[model samples]
Target: MRIKDLFLLLLLFSSLLVNAQQKEIDSLENYYHYSQDAKRMEICLELSALYRNIDPSKGLEFAKEGITLARHFKDLKTEAAILNEMGVLYRKLGELDKAMLYHKDALVIFKSTNDIMGQAYCFSNIASVNIDMGYYEMALEYANRSLELKKKLGDENQIAYSLRIIASIYHESGRYSEALPYYNQAMDYYERLNNKTEKANVMLNKAIASSSLHDDFTPEIVDSLFSQAQIIYERVGSKYGVAAVHFHRADWEVRVENYTAAEQYYLKVLEITKEIDAKVLYLKALEKISEFYEIIGRNQTAYDYLSEYVRLQKELFSESKAKEVASIESRILLREQEQEIDVLEAQQKTRNVIIVMIFVLLIAIVLFLLFFNQRYKEIKRLNNKLNDEVTHRRKSEEKLKESEEQLKVLIEDKNRFLSIISHDLRSPFSGMYGLIYLMEEQYDELSDEKIKEIIDRLSKSSSQINELLEDLLSWANLSSGNIVFKPEIFNATKLINEVVDINTYRLQTKDISCRYDSSTQFIRADYFMVKTVFMNLLTNAIKFSDSNSQIEIEREIIDDRIVFSIIDHGIGMNEDALKKIQQPGKHVSKSGTMGEKGSGVGLLLVYDLLKKHGSQPEFSSSPGEGTTVKFSLPVK
Candidate 1:
């Protein structure tokens, strides 16, 4: 049979398996109420997961019921687990605030109950959400906390998961050097656990990191890594994993300029996503394909794919919200029934006490009345005191939370400054020192040509160092709220040309050309800040480009704003670099295409300056293809 036919057969089998699982769930539901408390909670959790992808409403219903039962039994451990599940559900629905709230709440309960394992899981969940929010600092912090706790617990699978999260955070920050050890550690643990699924995931992650570190690993090793992951995923019948493997492979193919293989792999990803009914992955594949088409200059096809992606993404969000509403209503109704039962039980207990009192009333009615009056007053006094204590405790908790948040901000600032000192300042100065020392040693024997070359290199390094110092000062001034934004009307074309003129020498030195296509659009913004944005972007284009490659700078009026872009067909960046470049104070420098040097802090300054003018920068790149960085400013 053909590959397509085989896929259809496998899909049919998977559907049948799903149906059988549903039947088992139905059987469990029929006898659910008869089961013991512990068994019931287990069953509910199982049913929730089984239904999670099939019907989100049913999944949430089961999860909500499980949470309610866990709380009623005072099962804090189980409740924390269920809350984490609820957070995951909310995250899937794109309700980030609700997801964060639930995870934080779970963390608090876990800490209070001293459930170390639950606390680790809470940390992991928080880290994942923070990663999604692009809060790399917090993500790293939480991932490390989770890893530490898991280490103490000594569970291989849990430890592996924690390690993976930490690796992921490091990788996301473009710190692949820091990430590799964690990846290797996680791989070993997963192998010891014999967890094929997680092993496959780790392999894929390792390959992605390898892609970013061009000098550390060979292309063959990376390809082999991807292949191993693909085999494991396929063997385990993990459609999601298989799709992920394909996507990564596609990315690698693009990097190697194997356009045909990349296109085929991308299509395969879409096919697998569709077969597995994975909407999010399907959407992601569509977007990647759209970008691929754009790369190949098929604008119409790219737009068509993008349009479909946007439509499906919106639909998915709407569907998630609607299901959430239905599940919430179901949960509320179920809780009401539980509450009614509790009320009835309480009423019965009260009646029994009254009857017992009546039976003893004839013997000591007067004595009992005097004692009851005193007891009532005493109970009321204690209740008042308890309420006051609860209020005070709550206030203390709020203050503690505020303090924790402030501490996080402070730590982030310190780390940023430390990065500046450690890398930005040290790297250039260290190079200058070494070069000066070498020149002094070779002064008598060196030829004039060699001396002139060294001087030129030294000049270039000095310029880079000077640029870094200036950017650092600008950033410091901005952070201190001392840099004033003076908005004025300026021609976008004129400003771009000026920036190009300023960087003309850098471009000519590399035998590169700069071209601009801009209308006579005007924008009201801080002129110097805008100019700096263009300068940094243009310089970056020049830095990353190979000799003789052309840079395209364009400005267009889009929706009453001037959209400016600097395009370079040079050594492109990976996703990690893109993420790191966008993050404030977290940028890391890499050597340019022609051994050009940089301080890596320019983008950070540019980002802050753009935000100062109410604009957001955007980046798009694939390795070897090129990069496009753009932002829009309001028209005057």
Candidate 2:
């Protein structure tokens, strides 16, 4: 059949599946109105699970309702189940951190309840979230834990699921050879259970892995596997599975140099993914087709497809979508507050009834008037205590509001930091692309000198990108608190000289001379951190210095501390610019004297490393003269 006809059939099949799910949801909602307490919570959980793939927002609404009911009924198991389902929904929505939080919360409850099965499920969910967040090692660890738990429980189906997760983690981490055996084991289990959809998924993944193995699996064998998976997917009416098969088939074709077949397969993937509204898959298809076009020298077509892919990606992760997610969370919180208010109102009504009954009894017993007066006084005192508690709660709420505001500021800073990194990274790639395109399209028309200059520019751009990436990674590690400060006695002079030697090429390029006294100076500090600080400072000095300029590296003993300084006859910053650079969370980048690029992450990293060692770098600079940076470390 033609690919278009095949996609049409797939679309029709997907519509049927969607309709079936919708009908089931409607029936559950109808039954929910007639149910009470636990049954209602069960319905909510079911609906949430059903809506997870179709509409995560709707799933979240149902999950919230389920959580409220489960808590009211004191059903910890059900609450944990709902929480896990909510995590899955959030993962689908691309809120990975939120998903991880929900999964961890579910795991805690499962542990408290001693529910091994629930705990296994939570581990698997957490593994899935870690996989989404690109933490493959953590994902593998959790997946193995889940598999062990499933094995202990002797549940073959759950064990198979865990095996699949483990295999996927390996696959995503580019350990396809290791992933193959796990996929085989999972596929065997699904085959034994006669689970056609899952069996097809495993077949597809196995085929992809095999294709990536080059000579290990023949092209014919890979083709046979794809055919088998497609047959099963069509029989099960799984359009997603079929689309995935087509996407990988395209990749296999490209690997085998069958460009025409790859193009057709890619088009089929796009059509099927778009028809089924599988946006992530659709985006992948768009990106692959763009690359495919570029490889075939169809530059305009490639550019068009790339533009579309970028637009779609931005749309997927837009600020407006982030705000929508925030709105959903806010609404959930509001609902919880409303539920609390309802409970309080019910308690207040019961108390009022009790007080009225007591008053009536007191009216009948005039003999105990003194005792009644004393009781009334006690009740008034209790009321006053309740008021005091209310005031305290209000104050706590105010503090919580302040904390939330601070969190918002932090989030904004994080976003801005990411934006700056993105721009800096993109600038070099953009220049490289233009240079490459010029080389490709007009190589014959250009002179040897021009070609050499273009190559040099490409090299420089690549170097800048590399430097930015290194700085970015270091900053990320520092910000995440992954870098440990392991202080040990080390020769400060030697470390400084080592850093200076590392930048020897840059210094020679600028024709700048660096002078340092060769004196042994021992200091207690993190060796790697100190080295990084020295590297950044010296590199910055080299970048900003004029040709034939002098840089002095000085060390002085002051009591129990050793002060280190790097001074350069460079283009110095003004007061305003220096202030901005010194401030925390401020990313400042400017061109050097020779038009060299920077990511502005170097100094931030320097500041953080020094801060960890109980010191801070002080800078002195004016626009015309030079700059000096000094910091201290313990001599003991």
Candidate 3:
């Protein structure tokens, strides 16, 4: 525990850490004393990166100074390399536009010098920034540019890096199909190079593509990729990369719905990310945990997760996106102006000689042949590409048309069936009425007591039949899209009372005390549509209640909306029974308490009617306990 002992212990720890980074460190150290200033600048940039975490401000300062020195010494190659390094650091610092500016500047310089490898690196860097910024179109453009440059230069390593950047963009943007080929290419190149670290990075990207597509990620390629990334990350002493590896592993497990393993890996990523101060990685970890909790029906945990997510979102988006976009455009304009000035100078130097050499007939013949061949090839290629696209589009259009026709046929059939059933049912019930009338007329003196009973039976049966017919027609009207939604102001409290009065006999039959504590809020809704919902719900509650059971009706104004609920502690449905409840026109009659038969069309009609006005009943119920059905009415 002595000072010397502590120092030695620290030294030993440092040695262990550097041992992992020794390969990169040694390569950089050797490059430091190289003969050229460009080579020296390359080493300095890497050194700055290695120390970025231990001291960020110093690292940034060192990288900037190296870039300046490279530029001052007229070492364009070194300048381009240093710019890429600065871009990477700026990207880590969350300065996306600044990173892009540096990368683009380097790209222009590299192209001027015909430094193809440098140009490819710059393109990849710019593409990465675009990906993070959600500019997927621009990202793909830069990625393709990088690929072209790398392929022409025949620098396989740079080509691999280009492919990796492209795959990362596609993977991040939820484009699995587009991403797969790029990952495969990157992986192939890394394998050929035997570059363990880069190979692992590419492998992780491939795994990510698979996971995004929801492919089965078992102990095969997924595990292999994760293990490879872990190894290479540890070998390079890159905590950030290590965190990424852990995050990917956790995400892979999440896709397979394995929450426990995902949670463990997320925790590991969190622990390492804290030391590295990687805010983005921390946000990603929080998002993954939130999604996992939601699948298990943990609402409170999901809420907490979303809160953190929204907080991070505000931090990223609420600041200066417009300013950054404008600044980039302004810079592009300035560069174009400079290019115009350069072009004018070149024209001045070549004008006289170019004019003296002009030939008419031979040039015209050459141009004609060139244009003819080019036009033919262009047309052929376009036709070949568009043939399948046109066919697929035609098929999609036909499917849509067929679906519409089927829907129309189904609607017509339902209307016809309703008309037939209602007409037939009415005739039979009407015939019984005629028979009773004839019996009363012919045998008026049969018996006074028997006559009284027959009249009562006639009244009850007629009432029941009328109620059934009303419900069936109401449902039919709503289903055939004949219901009108005319929003008007009405006192909802008074409306409920009116519905209560209309159904008084049904309520009185069950001896149920109907409690109404309506809110004093006037609502803007379709009057008839809202009334239908209230009456149907109240009737159902009364029908299901046992004798002397109290039906509680309540209303409230919450969050600028009218909420009316009928809560009854009666024969509530189990979940299975609730699932069988039909939509409009799907209901069959069922007997209520006191032998009062139900018109199932009432509920189905209510559901359809309420939904037309952008509202529907929500329910909470338990078997033998109760039910609460409420609807939300929009306010003016």
Candidate 4:
């Protein structure tokens, strides 16, 4: 095609792109004005991100509006999300301090809400800004932390992004070889997800890393990679990618002493950077061009480009400082407006006083009687209002105190539960770790039978660990009100049989037998919670029972309530222990006949659940006399 024809086509494409973007903005604006409540807040956030690159000032304005609306609605999640968008916008505008401030603010919210993914993203953003400021150590710390979190979340795209960030950190620190592995890992993940834009981005960086590796890189291979990345970027219309590729190519040409080719590539980089409004890339391209000219002995040309680069750098710095000043001025204006309101109020009070004084003498005698009556009425009304306010405040304080006390109790229970879990967890984990270490060290000298024995021990430890974790999570969910309580009609016998089957190993280990008479009754209660209660009761019975003992589970309909009991023939507790078990927080547990561990956490959980069901456990036990625990639920 002719040059003029190509130019016309490009112009048409640019016009169409501009028109499309404007239409999107207009549609969103209409929706924003017409929307209400959270919808309007959401539109504001959307518009904020849409305008972030095209018009940063407008983006910041929309972001501020979003934050205000979210705060008014007490929507912390929306507020945190908007804060992150504002941070990114500020970063794009080159306000690094403001960017970091917003990110840290969002981080506080994310941490408070326990949003792991949100926290990870915040850390990654902080690291990006730190990298820009040349704080490599801080950047590395945040990036690594983000990578670890993303890994745990098992989000491949996020993990890839994190890996890419870490690679860039290494690359910036001149550890090209160290960066290569991470870049490759990120590329592989992106490829597997079929993320064209991100995959291309990783490819470009990987190429750059290879180029920087000097003797380890083959020029042909690096060039091929760069070509592939550039094609993908161009296909995707990524201006940043295009600019980056051009700059890298210019650098490579300069390194190989191809002055003419380097000049052409540098000029292309500058043009693309200017088109994209990327000040940093444009300045870098100018600096690189100047260096190339100086090396080629064109001193005058080099000086002119050098001066332009310095001028642009200073202009960018001045713009950032001006923005900071503008922000401070805005805050000052808000304070001034508040002060103006105070002055207006004072003037109104003065006017009222003057009017009262002028009218005081007109009806002196009549006014005296009228004033007394009005004053009395006013005092009566004020007294009543004051009393109501005092009562309301007292009530509010009482509720607050009650909530605080309840929260404290829950926290203490959680701590105790966690302590038991940690101890239980530590035993299995430490055993597995030690056993694995032993096998590894003695692999060559150990017999096959010994290795098998070690494997068996590892499996047992793993099973114990898994069971403990499951119980811990279930209890935590139950206590935190996260578990949904849905009552339904279900056969009690089936649930009991399932619970018994689950504990078959323990039953067999103790050479114990369980007997239960199946009932055809349906109960109206939370099936899961009821099942958990049964499981805990049976577990406790088995733990306390001796080898070859019998555990009897029975269900009886008494006065329209289904009563369930688990009777165990084993060593029983004394009066004090029984009393302690019935009381809250005083869970007195002892080792079983087989030296099995007992935390009593399970019993406490059962007690709370039973109370929730409008009943309590009836425990009867004495030394060597055995124990019987029973609870009741409403029948359907």
Candidate 5:
């Protein structure tokens, strides 16, 4: 094709891309107006991400709306997700500090909710912002953390993205050799995933790094890589990506001493950045073009470009500083609101106490009047039937004594239940609080290993607290007869696999393997209840099982019932423990082989759920032998 024809085609393609994106945005906006509650919030979040690269200001507007809706709906996960997206938008707009603040806030929410994948993405985003701010060490640290989490999640695409970020950090710090291997790894992953956009991105980065290693990659090889990346970027309609390719191409040309070609590439970069309204890229182009002019001895032209670059830089810095100040003011406002809420709560409590006192005083006065009237009646009756009144009083005293004894029993039971709950819940929370306090007071003084250790402990405590709350809620619902048993036919095998999958981290931690037959088996039971039962049992087995041990899950058909068994090789129960387990109301749990603690309500929940299914859990164990727990459900 002729050069003019190619240029016309590129312009046409860019127009079509913009039109398509605008149509999508219009459709979403229409739907958003009609949508209500959670769906509207979801659309808002989607729109925010959609507009991020194209129009950051619009993206921030949608993100803020999403955050408001998420908070209103008490959806912490979605709120954190929108906060992270806002951070990305801010980063794109060159507000690095504000971006970091948003990401850190999102990270805190993700951690509190135990959203591992959300936390991983936030780390990656924070790393990107740090890179832009020239904090390479901090960037590398967060990037590695993100990479570790992505690997744990087993998400190939996310892992590749993390790898790419880490590579960029190295490349920015001038460690070209270290960056190359990571870029290659990321490229390989993207190639396998068939993600053309990311693959092209990595190709561009690899080319830049390879340009520094002329001994390994020839100039021709580097040029080919850049050509490949440009083609892909154009095909994908990535305007910013295309601009990046042009900017880097200019750098490669300058490196090869091709001043004329380099100047053309730099001008092309300037045109693309302006067309896309990418301020960051535009600033970079202006700086580079000024340098290029100086290199060619065009002092007057260089001064003009240099002056423009300085002005633009100052404007961006001023905008970023303004955003930082706004963020600080917003935080101060939030703090003030919280303090006002605390004061209101205190006033409300005082009013409640005063109201209660007034109610008690009124009751006391009424009782006094009733007592005076009763005494007057008693005085009149005493003359007529003193013996009859004495006999009635004796019987009444005996009945009152009996009622008091019953009330005492009820109070003791209530106290015992409350004690059990408070002890289990408070222990974990106190440990978590102590760790947090230590970190808050001495974070700067702590070594990395010590911080990691504290984090691990905090995670465990949080997990323990979460488990306790879940079990408590389940037990409360079961005891109150609020949990309805809705039976349905479902694949029992699939349920077992899901339960196992959720406990993967635990299984990996203990180095325990689970063995179950892959067979299609349907059973009639409450799907959620049965899932809960399986989860609790499997978790118990994992906790008890020694490292490198295997837990076997088996299902066999016996008559009309499907018998499911979980057998674990670990410390078995003694006679006392067995007796305790047999008691339906008793919460029977012990420290596991690895000294893992539990709220002891899990087994009670399991037993209650099994009973609702018209089945009982049978246990077989010896003091030194491993335990086997089996239950049956109706096969449909």
Candidate 6:
């Protein structure tokens, strides 16, 4: 390749890497430095318009900060101005109650100050709040109020805000006929203002309503809406807007059952969301991905992403942490209230106490007797409760310790039994096999076919005995605490191959075809132990299935673990069988789908091996449809 060609190739590769990412750094920078004062709440308002697309959190943050400062400075005008932004934030946060509280607060202040425009905006907020809370009548009333006020103020541009809220109310209230006109009206107002972002938002909202309400939702309409949203987002340099558009597009993809397309859009959304620190959107995106993966039976992958999302949520909205912060703020407010109350109360108490002292001067003897009895009774009651609690805790601890000791002893005894079975049983089987072979040769009065048949029968019996011995030995080795698992980086693909090979004879006889799929990512696991698990499950699957049945072997990494699933379209058990499988040694042996007999030991060995190696044996099966067994080991 020429040098120019190499440079061009590098550029293409770099573009490919970042093609899905948002590049709105400049817009984000422009938004950060606006003022939030009375004369400049207009600047704050402008920033809200910009921030909704670029970084909504930062927008909310700035708007809320202005609300705090405005309230602190007692500037009703500025405080009232942030109501719209506050509603937007609360709606996105999914806390419709808090959103309602802020909107109503602004309304009360604006109404008291006789600010018609601010009050009108508050009506719009109220309408949106009512819509989310499922109060259609209340929502419609507020929406109409906002429209009337907007017309009176002759603010045609602001009328669009009221129209959008009304449209949402109508959509949610099941009045599609009413909603469509309002949506179009809102879009037209935006067009008049030359506001591309608002126009796109309106169009997108219409698409959502149409798709959600109609069973046969047309793809063309959704595509058109998303295309408009994407262009507007790009035009305004808004990563948050781009993320939102991608997220919606992903939802549409899922509606069409195009999981691959959905995944691509979800990934794009995550990239943009992460870049913009759009945590709320990021959380929602991760959850959507989890659902998609789960639908396709990628449980492990679903689990991993769900775990991360849950972790982030716990970090973000920890009730205990929020309460702690609230407590700190509340305490300051309480202390100030207390100081004021104390001052007033102290003076009143002083006057009342003087009169009480005069009146009590004659009743001191009676009061002393009453105070002494009350104090003694209260202290005794508290002491008794404390003693009872301590005694209860002591008994609970003792029982827990006893249970732990019993479990430890049971595990040790189980390991000892396994060792004995491996050693003692193998010795007798070896001796019996040797004696049978000698007899076969010495007693040659039988024909050649008879001798061959006897030898083969003995060999199959011996092999079954040997397999059992191996399982017990493996279990004992793991239980002995001497099976050091020095994890080496290995291809799960190759490990699965080797496991499938071990089951080849069984599979071929039954006409069961096993399928294996893997990714390039290497998983760190105890290779031998993991391989043993795969071998056991595969063997079980093939054994259970009839001739011409299919067995699928699935493997995937979910977060920090490697999961393997063996699924067979074979003779499956019901819920009762599932219960028996949990405690492996308890189930009776049954013939395979191909008339192959089992030691009933296969499941026992699998359970023991998994228990020893540290993976949970999980399965779900019916009477005849199929069986699936899954096990997962931690990835290093």
Clash counts for all predictions: 0, 0, 0, 0, 0, 0
Better of 5 and 6 by TM-score: 5
Indicate the TM-score of model 3.
Answer: 0.36
TM-score of 1: 0.42
Residue 325's C-alpha lDDT in candidate 1? 44
Which portions of model 2 miss their true places by more than 4 Å?
1-19, 54-65, 89-102, 214-220, 237-240, 267-287, 298-636
Least well predicted 10-residue stretch by lDDT in candidate 3: 1-10
In candidate 5, how many clashes are counted? Answer: 0
Position 633, candidate 4: lDDT? 97
Q: List the candidates ranked by TM-score, beginning with the highest.
A: 2, 4, 1, 5, 6, 3
Model 6, span 1-636: residue lDDT tens: 112222232233233233233334344345546533454555555565455533455456557567766777788887777876777666755558878887888888899899998888888878877876789889899999999999899898889988887886777666665787899899989999999877877776776666665565577876887888788878988666677778777887887788898889999988987887767678778877887787888878877776667556545544534544343333333333444456486733322322332233224324434543463453244233334335434654574566457555545545445444556455547766775877767776777777787677677767777776677556544543437766677777888888888878888877778877855546667778778778777877887887887888787778788787889988899897778777654534566765554545556556665765577788889988989888876665
Q: Give TM-scores for every candidate, taking all chains together and pairing residue i with residue i.
A: 0.42, 0.45, 0.36, 0.43, 0.40, 0.39
Worst 10 residues of 2 by lDDT: 1-10
Q: What would the per-residue lDDT of candidate 4 be over residues 288-319, giving only the tens digit for each residue?
A: 78878878999788767766775685577457
Candidate closer to the true structure by TM-score (higher is better), 4 or 6 = 4
Ranking of all predicted structures according to lDDT, beginning with the best and ending with the worst: 2, 5, 4, 1, 3, 6
Query: Distance from true position, residue 325, model 4, in Å?
Result: 38
Q: 2 or 4, which is superior by TM-score?
A: 2
Tell me the deviation in Å of residue 562 in model 2: 83
Candidate 2, 298-322: lDDT as tens digits: 8788777766775676566455346
In model 6, which range of ten residues has the least summed lDDT?
Answer: 1-10
In the range 173-239, model 5's lDDT, one tens digit per residue, is 7788899889999989998998998798789778878887756768888889889999999998887
As for lDDT, the candidate ahead, 4 or 6, is 4
- Which residue pairs in model 2 clash with each other? none
